[model samples]
Target: MSNDLIQVLQNLGRPQVLVLGDLILDRYIWGDAERVSQEAPVILLQADRSETRLGGAANVAQLLRGLEAGVSLAGVTGDDLDGRELRSELEALDVNCDAVLVDDTRPTTVKERFIGRAQHRHPHQMLRVDREQRTALDAQRSETLLQTVLPLIEKHQVVLISDYAKGVCTPEIVQQIITHARQVGVPVIVDPRPGEDYSLYHGATAVTPNRLETTRATGINVQSSDDAFAAGRQLCEELDLKNAFVTLDSDGIAVVQANGDAELLPTRRREVYDITGAGDMVLATIGVAMADGVSLADTARLANIAGGLEVEQIGVVPITRDQMLGDLLTGPRKTYQKVCDLDELAQHVSARRQLKQKIVLTNGCFDLLHVGHVHYLQQAADEGDCLIVAVNSDASIRRLDKAPDRPLFPQQERATMLAALDAVDYVLVFDEETPHALLDRLRPDLLVKGGTYRRDEIVGWELVESYGGDVKPLSVIPGVSTTQIVERLRGQTILKRPAVSQAHAPERKAG
Candidate 1:
């Protein structure tokens, strides 16, 4: 099932994604909690450093970009320094900033969280101060945002309405985006606000509401999947939503389709942390997956995994495609999380280039796990600090006429397994038969190829060398191949095969 879902991700094209809603800046102040003050009873904070990241709807754009989807963000930010800084941050991630408007009346929504650590241990959030407004965007500014966002809806395959209820997602603005998006036959996914009035988001393709918000919006006591489903159904019915989803905190997520079909994704077991942006991650994943034509249930599972990954982090961390796949195998790593879109790849490359890090890229159809793949991956890892392994999806493998019943495991599973290894820093799945386009996008410092291929014979070698990137070729395993494994398994009795450790040969190397 995981493999099947991963196949959907592999087949996902770089569809344009538009995010419309409030823009916020999240600030984290880290410090040490020492002795109390001499005059008053206040704990002294020995400040260390502070950092800022995108919040609210802007965060949805960041996650989409990390997932390799083309993203355009439309929202309103105050004309203060924070607002300008927020725009800079979005432009840094290569998000289209033209639609991000500015108003001088209100301040940019800033959620400043103070985290304190004592006695050199793990730090915890102590306090939070929000500096912003919750009132509706002024009439003129609202009209301006509508004018800016209406045209953007027709240009995108998917639209996300991230309602922080910070005034940007007014009824007028919501109606304009949703109405135009529907006219263009695009899916409009809404991350609804927490209130009884859901009419503001009416006509959206799907609505994602947490347990609390779902209960408030539908006036239902959501204690179980059945109750959540009831609430979701009510919301879907009221808002004419095609997909009704209720996110249950520890239990899981429940979805009620327009046809009344309901399914609950059981909570993937994990340690919970600050669920700051889990809902945002869920909404983004489902929106993009829905646009990509994935099944409703699989997209729910994908969203569930993304939410789980987000809570494990301290704050709003963008959920990337690689991180999403990596979480399916195990968990997420800081550096290996994002799989950049072509537009955003330049930004990541520029950042990496500034850091002077070595990049090694390799491509393969890693259908099933084997020792040879791991050994080659490790060899590839040795060539650079960051190793990017691009796997071919089941469809892509079939398109290449690689083998019958190829990719026993789905593309997601292959990418996840490879990313679970310590040697691999990132994994990308390409549906294209030839990775020449992907190579052109990345143009890594080193290109690694396995299975006895000469540097000159390898795909994209010339392109890599064009940018002074070298190509490294390695040997294949003595007697290891997916076909031999399948043949050996078929050759032996089904029950007997499980008892045997080696499928193809008497000896097998550890993967």
Candidate 2:
């Protein structure tokens, strides 16, 4: 099953997914709590940094992009700076926000969380304050939004409704969306709000509700698989839904279909740090998989894995396709398996950054794989949690004019040699003479170079420093060098072998 899913992921082409719901801006004020307030009993927080990210349905769009889906977000935000920033962020990720209407009457939904840490430990949320209006939109504004969003359903393969119980997800809009999408033969999935009256989401294809929401809607205590199945079955029957998905925190997801089929898809136990956006991640994964026409069981499995990966992180972090692929591997991976192409490495780097891991990158033409090169890479690895070694291609080395025939090995050989070392987490071959383009894409946390050049003279130093990344120079081993090794080999009487012709070369297996 794991292997099957891996094949599914490898061929999971980009599918257009339409998301409709409330848009929110999540703001975090990070600080340190070391002292008490002079006049009050609250801890005095010394703020250091502030960050803003997408929330609510906007977060679902971001997650869909991370999963390699073309996303279009349709919702409402206030005609304010926060709304503009939210739209800008989505656009940066290539999400279509043309349907993101603005209402000057209500403020954009903003959830401001104050986080504090003591003695340089892990940060925790101290308090959260919400700023917005919850009243339903006026008749005029609602009708205008419906007119804009109704036509977009035809352009998408699937429609996802993320209702945070905000003013945007009114009864009329939800029913119209479902009815219109059904008429066009498009599936509609809803992440319903926790309430006893779920009639707003009736006649939908599927509905995803957490345990609390299911328990409330079905009047059943969802503690075991049987309980969850009972609740899911009740929802599917009462709401006329084809399927009901109940998320059971650590146990997994319980799914019940209208045809009297029921099953509990168990999830691997993960260390729960923060489950801020697990539901959104699950919704995004389902939308992508269903768009690709994956089976419901397989889609549920993928969603479980995505949601599990989400909880291991601190806050609302997007899950990437590479992260899913890495988690789907059944056993330990070989060192050579770490060798990746440019696109795969970029995806892995994005996932690592979301997990708060530091990345270190270094580049060179490691032709012979000597101790000096190994020592430099080990030092670079010590600077960060993950070290990526970018090897120069054979054509690039020749362009550098190092010598008449400088590189003794091919790019594949050099990359395999580098991947065999414990210090390197990933090895990639670049055709560029300089690592500038690679640096721009990976954006490593630290850029390390091993040579006699000064810190400022290193390539990409300015580019690295521009993004708050550090640049350093490792100590060059004086007595050992690849040039010296080649000279010594030339002095020795070595026997040369004839090159094998293409027809006589061994047949290689398909990748």
Candidate 3:
């Protein structure tokens, strides 16, 4: 993917994402398990902190907003404390909750989890208490939700249905939404509830079902990759879905298309902390990427990476664009290092240069690294004896990024990561908008970029050329970029929904 494509994906700034389904609140209670209770055999807990987050369809909207997409949520939230909390969380994430109807008949879906922590072991969940109504939404409420969301759907490229089996994703509502979305040429992606008849999602562009859900819905045993592929194909054909993506926990994903072509994506290795809200992350990311014009195969690859990142953290954590980009940059390169300071990094670079290395230097805020960036960096590294990467300081990154929450990774850490690579010999940290002054100081033997423009396109290209340094063009990596990575990581997987198959099943590892 060219840097321009990455830029296009990042600058997609607010492509409205329509969310229709059950809205809920996720409440987490963090505490320490110290002793057994005197009256019961339960472990006594010392509470530390409590947090409330958007859940269900509300979470889908939040995930879209996290990817910098304009999000509008249309769902039913009860007139209760949990409902209010859900609204508050959505507003905080900048998601439009105006269409969120306040239903009085049902209690808002609230999943409360109690987490116990000790010194060195993994945190364990004591209990998950759920409050919800599984009955269908009333006619009045269903009409109200449709009236509020249909117009908004016309203006967006993608629609997401998040069903928690909480009655809000009624057959009438889902069918109406999907029919309308298709009429307007908008694609609808659904995270389906298991055991619910697939008829509700009759015309959806795609459906994301976890292994267990796919098994239950299709009555196919998903104990192996072959079973998953057969089950996915059956579900797709039976439901008339454009695609069926079956998420196999740890083993990765199997995608089955309407045409019978299946593709299996292997899971990335990770030390999982909590699996909460991983599906939401995948849904939001795939939706955004497809909306932004990413291909299906590329979208699935990005989603896999995003899902991996989310599972590494606890609870419902939003994966930032910068973090996703960083992953893309590091994914193709295996060399890693830990450097404490700039002096140390520079010394490392000098040592590499001393070995007659042609040092290729390039600098950027790299606030959100994408495929364009990885391709550029890798190509740049290929041109020199040793690639010297210079990153803008936090202040510079903020100046270039504008957003306060940007550059998820600080300069020092970013530099350390870049320096640890075998392709990179040194990393320089600078506080300037342009790397002109730094280039003058470093006087690298070569400078490179991924764009089609001549050396003049780089801000410091002239300086390097004037200093008798070589300026070169590096071929852009197709279909791999930072922006796409961000969208994919944020849970959008529709356009590039993976093809499911047992023949191409993912390799399994022993735990």
Candidate 4:
């Protein structure tokens, strides 16, 4: 399952996606709340920073762009500064906004949130103020929007409707979009607004509704997967959708197909900092996968993962393809799972590098794990986002000839011990003397070693530095050498295994 998901993520080809719905500008005022306000009983917030981000359908389009999809956003915005700024931001991300319509009568939809942090902690939302016009668009403007966007649907492989119930998604426009998209063999996915009547999104390829919205639409009061499936089934049947993806917050996504097949696609539980744009991410992920003709189950799974990743962040940060691949490559935090072969390790490193995460690598025999090794590994982990601890193979250790009898622990046991450390992100055993081959393949951003040796004397230092990689030397604990421990054990009447002769030795290596 991991490999399959990784493959899907690796092969996410760029597809043209059309995004149509309400466009919003999200404004955040950031500050520290240090005292109470004298003017009122509310907490006093001294604003220090402010930012504006694309929201609603614009957020979906930006998310698609982050996933390497070509995106065209079609939506309505007021002919004001906020609208212009929103379009500029979209254009900066290479999103095509030629279809964005401007109306002079209304103000741009803006959601302003004030965030306050206390005692240098994570910021929390103090309050939210919304500026929007919920009144439905007039008939002439609605027709103009339809005429402008309907013709462009055929140019795209997938159409996404992100409805915030902000007047852009009228009944006529939504229905026409789905119908026209269907006629041209293009799929339409809707992130429907919370409303009693979902008929506006009828005949769409799929609908992604959160639990509360699903309950409101289906009247099922979804509290579990069973209820979610029932609610999703109702949406698919009543709205003529091919599938309904109901997102049940931490419970993951429940997918129900028109053919009565249903499954709950579970997600890894994340420390949810904020759920601002999780729904938009899910819709974007599914749209991109659907554009490439991925299966419904796989699409839902990818979307589920995307949503989980989005909530782990503080705001509407887009989930990139590399981030998804990295999450899949590094699954559960199992000690055994951290140990990988050279080829698998290369794949994991590639994913991390794509996500712009630094890779710190160190190589040693690690025959006898001790506090010194743990200390070094912990320091190495601080050098980058992930630490790759390379251990020498048993044969390599034997060829090194540290003593007549060396490497008391086998290579597998040594690697397992290293993997069990929280500081070690990945463990691999190399047969070669030095990790020149591994370093050349992985090209880690930082090469770390624990010893008194200078950076130039470290193994693979020159090779690593040749490619703009850094080399760092750490302090080792005094009198903590494995040879010293082995000698102490020998003095205590410990039995030693027979050493293999050098006759069949592949080559000499050192730790």
Please report, in order, the local distance difference test score of every candidate based on alpha carbons.
0.79, 0.85, 0.74, 0.87
Which candidate has the highest lDDT of all?
Answer: 4
TM-score of each: 0.67, 0.67, 0.67, 0.84
RMSD of each: 11.1, 11.4, 18.8, 4.5
lDDT of 1 by residue, 1-511 (tens): 5444555555666778999888989999988998799989887878899999889998998888877888999888888899999999999999998899888888999999988888755777888999989999888888888888888787888999899888888888888778888888988998888889999888989998998998899899899899988888888888998988788977878989988889998766677767888888898888888878888888888888888888888888887766665554334444335443444444445345545678888887777778888888889888876788877767877776554766688877777778778888667878877778888888899988766466776778888898788987876786665655675767844444433323422111110
Question: How much RMSD separates candidate 4 from the native structure?
Answer: 4.5
Superposed by TM-score, candidate 1 places the C-alpha of residue 198 at a distance from the truth, in angstroms, of 0.7
Candidate 3: C-alpha RMSD after superposition: 18.8
Better of 2 and 3 by lDDT: 2
Instruction: Looking at model 3, report the run of 10 residues with the lowest lDDT sum.
Output: 502-511
Error of 4 at 439 (Å): 3.9
Best by TM-score: 4
Query: What residue runs in model 4 are displaced by over 4 Å at the alpha carbon?
Result: 1-7, 31-40, 79-85, 117-122, 295-298, 312-315, 319-332, 355-358, 382-385, 394-407, 431-436, 445-475, 492-511
Return the number of clashes found in candidate 1.
Answer: 0
Model 2 RMSD, rounded to 1 decimal: 11.4
Q: What is the Cα-based lDDT of residue 181 in candidate 2?
A: 94
Of models 3 and 4, which has the larger TM-score?
4
